[model samples]
Target: MNAFLQEVLTPGSIVQLATLASLIASVNFGVVGTYVVARRITYIAAAIAHSVLAGIGFAVFARAHFGWDWCAPVLGAIVAAVISAIIIGYVSLYLREREDTIISVVWAVGMSAGLLFLYYSPGFNGNLESFLVGSILYIAPADLWIMGALGLVVVLLCLFFYNPLMAVCFDEEFARLRGVNVPLYYMLLLILTSLSVVLLVQLAGIVLAIALIVLPAAAGLHATGKLWHAMCLATVLAMIQSTLGIAWSYTVEIPAGPAIILLSAASYLAVFGWKWWQSLRAASSLPIRS
Candidate 1:
């Protein structure tokens, strides 16, 4: 700490704090990833990430024309994500199968359209690479506040809807019979999930966001059977990864976002292997009937 104070704090104290504030966005993403996996909404996460480009591009256009940063992206992202979710819902309902395949089509088509539109709009592709790959250390404080608020909202709502969600994930038919309003629950879930993608991808970039969300939840799930336990473990794992990734990124030459996610993934794989071995050994110990 003293050494860093002696050396790399050149932009003055405020600038350093401001610079560090950028990383809060990534932290928010890490926390959000848990619920995403818990609900088995990874593809939805991916789709939302892809769809954000159109939202961002449209937002940028709005910003240029009207100069309101927050409102534009909020409206655009909600529109894009809701439309995708609704389409995915209806298509799946009618086809009664292949939801993932249908969602993928939506994801691909949305991104292609976004890219094409961006190609035509001036500066539409500006730093688009960062959105796809993530450059979290560049997130501004204003952006951090926004991301933090969104994360809080999502997590809070998850807590409120915890029971129904658990039922929905475990057995939707049972939940529906129990008067869980499965479709409405899912609608709310998708909305929050889409919002999460927007915020997380903003930090880790869309590409890295998947790792941050999935690896921790998967690892946590391996660690425990209970949903709350899994959620807690995933959050802790995310925080560990986020803090370590930031530290390592500063210490090494690698980008912070991917570095953290890769580290989390490696950790998850090690634990997963251990869990599998444990399960196998336990199964082997069981007596066989003659």
Candidate 2:
């Protein structure tokens, strides 16, 4: 453990990068994930995550074809995510009947558009593995700084609007009756979800982004009933899983992204098993009705 810390603590090292990425992921997932699970909008988050690929593709194409040095893929991803959230939120609220259909269509078309754009972009010869599966080892200082700012924004928003968000998530009708803007809050939730998806994509890549968002939050919910308690627990759990996954990956020489996701899954299962055992013990302690 000491050696691991020493290696990871070095400035600008891959281990440092992984650590920063995981920390940012923990913040984003911990806060936004709680709302996601509460509102049961994991599918919407997934749709936004995939749709971000379109933005990345466009950014890449623009940079390659037009020599736009300012076209950062992450910036493009944020724009795409926000736009996708608006479309999904609008449809789900005003056109409830077609919500599912729109999500499905966006999910598919976004990825397809990304792939096509990448194929046609001239003078581009970068591997897509990192974007698809993630490459934490290659994370630069710039990425870490951007992620940090975004993570701070998520934390602040959640803290500032906790009650309204909780009301919206647990009971939209109640929230509406209480004079909270239901539609606005709902859109805010989706927009936050979009940002969280973008952050997770950096940590776990497009393919496994949802796992980072959902698994830790699921474990938190299983362990606790209170929303705030669950959110705090989920954040801690995500940090643990991410750190452990990076350590295990270093030991075994495996990809960090998959390792982190698999570890998160394992942690969730462990929590579930413990919860089940507790229930069984409680049931066993009860007197037989017969």
Candidate 3:
């Protein structure tokens, strides 16, 4: 723990980088996550998150076999994420009856495709584990820059489309009636969700990405009724969880991603239980009625 603190205090150390990554990543997690939870599209987000691996795997294969120096995994992730979001959004909008089946297909195919690509790629693919379970402590400065840029884009877009998005989430029919392009906004929401999920995959990896994205926002929702309030609280909770999780992981020598996820899960449960207890108390306090 002391050693970890010293490293963190050092300028440009991996520990510092990890901390910064978590903080920067938290903004998107909070904002986009609020929309995801509000629209009840967490399953879609999860599919997008896993589907990212397909892009990453293809990028790796390209770089290895075809010598495509420009095909970075992050780029592949962005491409795959956007494509998955579009497909999922289309199905949800027009093919409502097959929503679950389509989502399941996307989820499975994405994972399967990524694995097959990796298998054929001629190399040990050392970074696969990092992408799978995350290795924030090993991220470079370039990763930080990309993450920050993506975070900025996502937050700005959310702010610009706040009213339309809120309408879409709460009442799509009403939004359409009011001349707000409901389908466009809905697709926009899913795209933003995909970008956010990519950031989460970088931090927590695919398996744990959904947890970080949903838990904090869920907790915030339980604590507040307003959308903006929920976003703010969720962002703060994400940052706190990231920091504490890093600290705990360093002290105990556990995996940082899982530690962060576990902390988030515990916090959400605690907040949920407290809210439930309060509701029970409020109900019990209501004087004898009828």
Candidate 4:
């Protein structure tokens, strides 16, 4: 046990660092997943996750270095992501007429901005590559701590504002009628969504954060009807995938990012298939009356 603890003590070791990341990722997914099912807006998560790259690029370019400090990338990413969120939310609300058009532009522009920054940085041809395909095994202890702290904040907020957030995410009109600050909650959700992107980018990178955020949540959500319970189950599922995926990656010598995603995909498919089989069995068991 002492030896095991020592192994995890290092930020570079696969066991210790990845374990922290797995927990951080699980909690992050649980919070984001709640809105995902409530709003039925899976696409929004994907869109924002991709578009966040633009904001991160701005942060990176301003600093002119990736490894200087985690704070730099995080601040830059948050600014870009929140601005993008506002643009996406504003267009979807007021311009409801051409919302899709506006959203597409938001996503495209963010990604393009990142690409341009990558071009300007010397010997940075792989900046885009790093964001797209993360190396899970390379996660730093400081980054894990950052993600864990962010996860705690998100979880606490969700606990305090559960009813308000649910009211807004699931039904804005009802929330407003109940004297809730519906718009405020909506804005808060989007801002936090971007923040989640920042925390996750550190673990799964920009490319895989969406998968980590949405996949396990979707799987558990689709299989269950209860909101809070679904979130719990999703957290467990995500944790399992993250831990197993890391172990598999270490053993197989594959990239941790892809490994985790592939495991998540497999878990989703397995649960989906099992659910479908149960439905079929239940349907067949209902006897027809002549």
Best by lDDT, which number?
3
Going through the candidates in order, what is the number of backbone clashes in each? 0, 0, 0, 0
Ranking by TM-score: 2, 3, 4, 1
State the displacement of the C-alpha of residue 30, model 1, in Å, after optimal TM-score superposition: 6.7
Error of 4 at 136 (Å): 2.1
Q: Against the true structure, candidate 1 has what lDDT?
A: 0.69
lDDT comparison, 1 vs 4, better candidate: 4
lDDT of 2 by residue, 144-209 (tens): 989999888878998799999998888888889989999998998899889888888888888889
- List the pairs of residues colliding in candidate 3: none
Residue 194 CA displacement from its true place in model 3, Å = 0.4
Query: Candidate 1: where are CA atoms >4 Å away?
Result: 1-35, 65-75, 93-95, 280-290
**Model 2 steric clash pairs:** none
Over 224-253, each residue of candidate 3 has an lDDT whose tens digit, in order, gives 999999999999999999988998998888
Residue-level lDDT of model 1, residues 71-127, one tens digit each, is 555456657776786776666545767888878888887777766655655645466
lDDT scores for all predictions?
0.69, 0.89, 0.91, 0.75
Q: Which scores better on TM-score, 2 or 4? A: 2
